[model samples]
Target: MGSNGSDPPRPVVGITAYGEHARYGVWDNESVLLPRTYPDVVIAAGGVPVLLPPVPESAAAVDRLDAVVLAGGPDVGPDRYGAAPHPRTGAPRPDRDGAELAVLHRALERGIPVLGVCRGAQILNVALGGTLVQHVPDVVGHSGHNPSPGVFGTVEVALEPGSRVGAALGPVATVRCHHHQALDRLADGLVVTGRAADGLVEAVERSGAPWVVGVQWHPEEVATDVRLMTALVRAAAQNRTTAP
Candidate 1:
């Protein structure tokens, strides 16, 4: 099913990957990793996926991409926002944090469409001078958002009407969530677009253009819902066609 020189080219989406030590095929080594679900959703949404490893120079690649996705990972360092690390906070991955912040800043400058999932969303906030709650259960008084290891909890998020996220996910959505931290103070030029019943921030988006959206939940975890990815792909396509 090759293109007959008619349809537009598929947008190239760059997704950030995690650098972790893993055991694979009897070999234990450090590797760049990302779940298959991220690329799978991108492809299903008519975009080509490229994995961006945590490297200082990775931000340079944003100029060559139509859009970017910040995938979920470990908790961001509290020092990023001048806060002391909470007892429950995960250790920082400096390489990942620096690389992602660079990529995000670059993408925003280029007006590239960006989607942040889980920790990706947190990265976006911290990069813009915002802070995180550090531990959700401490404030929310429950562990429903992250029931246990390797298990995703279901959360009902109320979307802000007329928001970009709402346009893609509708007024209310039952999302797959697995996070222990969430946005505390939103950055300038960004607004909260979704929240859980407990008033925890679940989604945020830029107030103006370029199509930046971040969700506390992992949209890729839900195979049945491709709306969010589709929306990103569509924005990327538009960016590709309109870029001067």
Candidate 2:
């Protein structure tokens, strides 16, 4: 339904898409349009999904949505977060890199509810002047974080008391992991809310914002995981209603 000034505005979430190729050696150089499972998660939680395509200008993309989601994808460029490439770091997609960074920067400035997942989490950190551990196995020398490539691993996360994510997800929660990269140097105002058994950071949220959280897990992969998407959609709904 359209907002006619009498009705509340429906929350719109901008989800970032990924680029693809046949092989690392031969770049297909074609935009790969894939749907993120999170948008369906958002829809199930009562929000609208606006696939935020790779745009040259981020501000314009961010302006159309009340909230934004940085979906999981290829590893972020090492140089972006002030690090050198690791053997495990996937080749960077420049188009996605430019689009997401733009959207993240504009979303932060606009006070939009931004949820970052996996690669999305890393993007959030980099956009906010933070860094990442290129390869968890290489740095931590452990396989608990990600046991199998593209497969979900079960891990318990201890949530910090008084954190938004903690409150939303209760004192603690067992979330699914699929990425090798993890949060390292936290961005300013971003407080680590959840951590894995290996002491790797799993979740982060803005200190003062109503909603700005990033998780190094795949909540969307599990439709039963409602709290994460619910919290996001709720914040987006509220933001849209109160948008000036």
Candidate 3:
């Protein structure tokens, strides 16, 4: 992805890749994978999408990204929040957990723009000492948030006026959602910027920070909602120009 004559370089957006077991081509295999829509949406938003596998050099790799997407995946282990695992909690992956946390910490320290989606948003809260409602349906009175295993359901969210997410999007939006967890206690310095009809926190933004945001719904899941990614890319490009 590029610009017309003399335009600035597109921001390099790094998206986290999760490891999974798969069968493809000639063999059953262990693979690093990301949904095509994630990167495709990024490119359409005028950014360079780079897949970032969990690695020992993750923090350093984060240093190189102009922006980062903490892609959705398995649950954050209860240990990170110092609690016993809830019955519905997904099995833990220390590798994915460790790698993304390192990248997040480094990115925050450097003030790089960051977007956290679904599990990404959960971990962003966890990373900042907030807790999560392990099984959202148990609290919300419906399994509609995640109608089935690996399925997305539609829901409406109301955005806070004058908030980052509200400003990027409008006062309300119907979005694609697929998750069993969401933010519990508010993280320090992170403000709730959106909420679902059931009143669960749907979005958060860090005040006084350079473009840090988290959304409980998957904006990448739908091609039409590229505003979030575009906002992130714009912030990233601005950060690049202002960086010393």
lDDT of 2 by residue, 52-171 (tens): 777766558788887888888888888887788888788877788888898888898888899998889889888889988888887778787778866688888999879878888888
Candidate 2 minimal-lDDT segment of 10 residues: 20-29
- Reference-based TM-score of each model: 0.98, 0.89, 0.97
Distance from true location, Cα of 75 in model 2, Å: 0.8
Q: Each prediction's Cα lDDT score? A: 0.94, 0.82, 0.90
Q: Tell me the tens digit of each residue's lDDT in model 1 across 41-134.
A: 9998888999999998899999899999999999998989999999999988999999999999999999999999999999999999899999
- For residues 1-244, write the lDDT of model 3, one tens digit per residue: 3687687778899999898998888989889899899999999899999998877576888877899999998989888888888899989899999889888888999999999999999878999999889899889999878999778989999999898888889999898899898899878979999999899999998987699999999999879779989999988998998998
Range of the 10 consecutive residues with the lowest summed lDDT in candidate 3: 1-10
Query: Residue 146's C-alpha lDDT in candidate 3?
Result: 90
**Pick by lDDT: 1 or 2, better one:** 1
Question: What lDDT does candidate 2 reach at residue 62?
Answer: 83
**Candidate 3 structure, TM-score to reference:** 0.97
TM-score of model number 2: 0.89
